[model samples]
Target chain A: MSLCVLEKVSKTYTTGDLVVYALRQVDLTIDPGEFVAVMGPSGSGKTTLMNILGCLDVPSSGRYALAGKDVTAMDDDELSRMRSEHIGFIFQSFHLLPYATALENVLLPTLYLERPVDGGKSRALELLSLVGLEDRAHFRPNQLSGGQQQRVAIARALMNDPELVLADEPTGALDTTTAAGIMRLLSSLNERGKTIVVVTHDPEVAAYARRVIRMRDGVPTEQPSGRTPRPLTAHPPVTP
Target chain B: MRRFISSLHQALKAVRAFKLRAVFCIASVALGISAITVIVAATEGAYRRAYEMVDRFGPDAMLVLGGSAEARAIGRRDKTITVQDVEALRQAFPTAYLLVPMSSVREVNISYGNRRHQTRVTGTTEGYSRSWSWPVVDGRDLSEADVKGMRNVALIGAQVARELFANTDPIGKFFFVRNVAVRVVGVLEERGTTGAGHNLDDRIVMPITTAMKKLMNEKTYVNAVRIRFLDARNMGRYRQEVRAFLRQRHGLKPGQPDDFRLLSSEEIIRFLVALTGSLVIFIGITGVMALVVAGFVLANLFLLSVSERSGEIGIRRAVGARRRDILFQFLLEAIALTLVGGLLGFVLGVAAGPLLKLAADFPIYFSWKAFAAGLILSMLVGLIFGLQPARRAAAVHPIQAIRSG
Candidate 1:
């Protein structure tokens, strides 16, 4: 079964004397172990699509299924549980809690779990180390640089060992070198059988993904990876 | 329970974020709870003192006075409890009692040669000592012979002795009360004061016979009669019996209230307590208003901060917090804040207790109920005040929070 499947989904909004279509008819599926990129300019419904896919927002019509379970049929709490257990989201600005240390931020998802996570602190520290931030685990967000903060966010995203990790402009605030370094880290995670989805308008960011789906005015078009093949062993592996 | 702890943890974070607002919220609650605590303690203390005075007034004692309550209010003595009534009362009741017929003339000028002092002249029998459970500190009490012979011997109170004799012995001294000369054969026991702040030990006591005949020139009546029964639990029956006997002896028709009034010790305490009850009500309202005002402050601040904290709420929601979790977090913040304030208020009230007692001679009692009330009232305010803001916080959309942030 596919990791995620969206079948003929449409999301609409109504304002005073006007109607807006954020997502028209859309059908998409994501398989496990695939690095998928969702690319679109501003107002192309890419953000809305990612929100619906992340279970933060519901569709106006049609079905969204995750791991054979229907997303639209789930209640708010059920959706919360699904997000906590199976999916991890990374925001463009790296929405890390300003007051919490990097290790505490990574352990945030465990606070909402159905059962207590044993060895949660050690796991958080290990994830921080996986993102090359083991020594910065105790540092607050204000104390960490932009790239380091994003790395802390990535470690947080991987806290519960979620099956699918979604990144919305994961490198939007970073320089080219830092952005490439982040993409390489994500690509390495995809190699280890985690389903990764990267949402961005930058073509350079899309070059790291194995598959790309471009959305224009609420409609999506699929494209294969257009970059020349590169050697995988150029950098050290980030896998745990 | 797990969800509650999680919410509590997050609530602490929220409180830490807005330190000024949190402090103000807590200060208001503390003020309210402290007011309630002090009021409760004061009222409780007043009742305790009132009851103590009543107990001292008499254990199983009832006093029959000479006038109507309304007439006494304006300082008019209607001359009711007479010689006939006293005789009838002595014959009617079981005489295994301390029955004392007494009459008093307040503001009488008593002169001991060069020393002149104004004091109440009370005329009663020797059992005045036993009836009051107040033994004479020096000299001797009034005797039964003194009452029967209508002698001019008297017992001066400690204050009267101090005033009339200065450092000299008041025993064997001659004092004249309004042209009636009396020899001070015994000094009365020193009583400090009544609960009504009347000086108990500033009177000169002579025989009721001498007082009626010699000082006030009255032979037909005595103004007061005091009775002490065996058991206090049977006081209700005693009150009815006394009322019936007095009315029958006084020749009253049916449905006519007796000219003479009867009072029980318990009734006196209850009357005083009822007075304090009004005071408690008045002050209790102010305390409750303080709490309500604090609650309003807390609610207003919470509502104001919700918009600012929406982004935080959104972040939590995206991280898998349920809507109720967000709501619980905010509610817990208010409850916890006020709980702390309540405890602090209780401490403040208790701390102020001794100072109030010293300053105003107030009776301030500390009981667990006051403590519990402080806690329960504070928490209730928090819950009531926090609900709206928590709901608003819980309703924040993650997309909007991210955009706003």
Candidate 2:
């Protein structure tokens, strides 16, 4: 079964007299252990699509299934439980609690679950080490560099060993080198049999994903793939 | 329970983070509570002392005195209360076990050689001591022989002894009451001053016969007659019998008003008790108003704290704390603060009671009930005042809060 499937999903937001169509008849399927990137311009409904897939929001109409269980009609508490158990989110702004230490921040997800997974602390520490932040476990978010804070956010996202990892412009605010480092960490997590979905406007960041789906005006378009074109030997060079 | 403990600990930690503000809040509440405690304790002490003094006078004793109107209409021509009235009352009422005619001569100058002072002198029969329950501290009381013989003897109070003797023994000494010499046979024990601040132990007692025959010249009627009933439950019967006897002795018609007034010690005590109760209630209401103001101050302080710590509350809620949890946390902070303040005020009030007594020149007693009331009232105030701010804290939206941060 696919990890997440959205069929004919739509989302609309009404602010006063104007109605905004954030998503229109969106259809997608993501399988286990796959890396996909969603690229679009600002206001092209990428974040809205991400929010729907992460269960932070519901589509106005249609079916959303996670691991073959229909979740579009779930209540608020059920959705929170689903987020706690099945989904992990990383935001570009690195939303870490300012007062908590890095380790405490990572422990937050497991606290919401009804019961902690075995060896929760050790798992949290292992995830911190996975992101190369094991030495900064006791430091608060304010004391860390932006790159380190983003790495801690990534570590916190994996605290519950979630099946699907969603990154919304994970390195949008970082330097090129730090962004490359984050992309590499995400790629490594994808290699470890975790399904990864990243939404970004940066083509270079999208290059690291195995599959890239481009979005335009709240719709997705598939691109031709799978074969490398033959090199035209010398004749095509400078013909003009 | 463990969660409650941790929550309380966090509440206290939050208060401790801002020490000066917490101290200011506590001190304001303490001042109000202490004021209430002092008033309640002093009022209770005064009532207790008044009751003790009333109890010292005999339980079933009643006073029959000439009324002002009757004394005026007679114009010294008709006798109001006299030795004959006492004799008649004793004869008419077998229930009247002890009837003594007594009169007071205020501002009488007494002298013993060089020492001279003005004092009140009360003349009564030997039954006066037993009827009034006044204990003789030293020497001997007046005897029937002294009364019949009209002997020149007197019993002085504690203050008179201190003033005239200057630590010397006063028994067997001779003192002159308005130029008439009298022998001192006994000294009364020191009875504390009355609720009205009259010194009960600052007077001299003389035999009625001697006081009437020698100093006062036996020419005037007596001031009043004190009667004691055999059984206190028969007081009404005794009162009726005395009224009838006075009417017959004075030859009054059925429609004519009685010549004298009859009052019981119980009646006087009841009046005084009611007065004290009203005073206590008045003072209590004032204290409650102050407490309410303190409660408002506390509410304002907590509201300010909630506003200042909105970010912290947002963080806690985001970390899986329920709305009820947040409310309890803030309420716990308020209750803890006020409870500490209440206890401190109780301790200070108790310690200050003696000093208050010295300042007011009256006795003050510590009461646990008042302390308990202060503590409970303070906690109740905290709970009531804390509700609004706690609810506000609980209602903060986590999503909006996070976005703002």
Instruction: State the lDDT of candidate 1 residue by residue for B43-101, as single tens digits.
Output: 77887887787778776998888887778888886788888777777788884288888
The per-model lDDT (C-alpha) reads 0.85, 0.78
Query: Please, what are the lDDT tens digits per residue for candidate 2 over residues A1-240?
Result: 789888888888899999888887888877888777888898888878887787766889878998777889987556667777888878777777665789977876765564646787898899899999899999988899989989998888888778888888899889999999999999899889888999999988887877666777777764421232223231112110
What value does the lDDT take at residue B375 in candidate 1?
A: 94
Chain B TM-score (each prediction, in order): 0.85, 0.81
lDDT (0-100) at residue B360 of candidate 2?
A: 56
TM-score of each: 0.82, 0.70
lDDT of 1 at B297: 97
For candidate 2, what is the total of clashing residue pairs? Answer: 0
